[model samples]
Target: MKRKGKRKMLIAIIILLVVVVVGLGGALFFTAGERREARNLPIGHVNFKQLHDGTYLGKYEGGMYKWRANKVQVTVSSSKVTDIKLIEHTEKQPTGITDELFSRVIQSQSLQVDTISGATLTSKAYLKAIEEALEVAQE
Candidate 1:
């Protein structure tokens, strides 16, 4: 009877350990996935023609989305970007080039400017937000 009780207790302990290990492994995988998604998001698919001419507002949400979040208010008339106002940008890791290129785009009405070295994605995201705002203005 004593031997049987000990075997049952050992089996129960093994099961609990396995469950704990599996849960931890699953959590780690999800965390890693979320991190990768924020760091490697594609920001180059923005279409320019979608932007309409006129003043518009934009907003960028924080968190993992911050990697992709950028907002700007742009005024476009006759296909020219007369003004660009950055509303809220939470670019935590993007390069300083975003700001430099942003000024160029506002003055040029074209995102054809060069990408900020090391901050290419952030630059794209800022343009995307500006583009998105202009697009909204068209409607």
Candidate 2:
């Protein structure tokens, strides 16, 4: 009787472990897909010359899982991107992308600026939002 009880307990523990492992694997797979989609997001060209002086709001609806969703307020002055403010983000922690990175966009007068290291996906999402705001300024 004692041996049977031990065997049942061991089996239950094994099943719980398997369930946990499978759940983790599924979550990882989903996250990997989301990251891949974000990494491949296209950053289109924004013509500063066409943008009128104005403040515009833009948003990225996030990719597959909406994990990186963000919004920005972009200011265009004299047909140039004068400033970019991060209004909101879904990231769990700050990704070190801030004024300096936005400064690059303003300085370049383009959305093709280099992304922040180790924050490529977040950078792209923000850039895309910026591009959208610029597009609105164009109209």
Candidate 3:
């Protein structure tokens, strides 16, 4: 009788441990999925033809993460993006990714451009800020 009771207790402990581990794993997986979705979100564009010629300020802070562009300033002139400025960003190192992204927006006149490879989160944040700024300029 004593041996049987010990065996049952041991089995119960093992089951509880397994349950805890699985729950933690599931939580981590879901969190990672959310981050991935945010990073891959499709960037939207503004109808430059309908946007009034002016400067606009936009800002975006990415999900719980530190890698993001805090603010951006965009200038539109005659239905074209004339300038893009990164007002603030949160990169630990100087990567020039923001500069490259700004140049692309100015040249293409659109936010539907490829993101920088290693700085995907920062690129997305910058694009989002540009979109927001342009949205304000819309007619």
lDDT of 2 by residue, 48-111 (tens): 8898988999999989888889899998888788889999988764635667679889888888
TM values, all candidates: 0.53, 0.79, 0.69
Error of 3 at 52 (Å): 1.1
Give the higher-TM-score candidate: 1 or 3. Answer: 3
Clashing pairs in 2: none
What's each prediction's clash count?
2, 0, 0
Cα error, candidate 2, residue 34 (Å): 0.7
Residue lDDT tens for model 1, 22-131: 99999888677545654464444334455556678765453353545767777777766677766666666533465577778866656667667776666666666765
Residues 1-139, candidate 3: write the lDDT tens digits: 9999999999999999999999999988867854686677667867767878899999886656544547888888987889888788776635487778788888877788888888777678878888899999995
Off by over 4 Å in 1: 1-53, 60-65, 92-96
Checking candidate 1 for backbone clashes, the offending pairs are 51-135, 52-134
lDDT: the better of candidates 2 and 3: 2
Local distance difference test values of all predictions, in order:
0.65, 0.87, 0.80
TM-score for model 2?
A: 0.79
* lDDT score, candidate 3, position 79: 71
Worst 10 residues of 3 by lDDT: 61-70
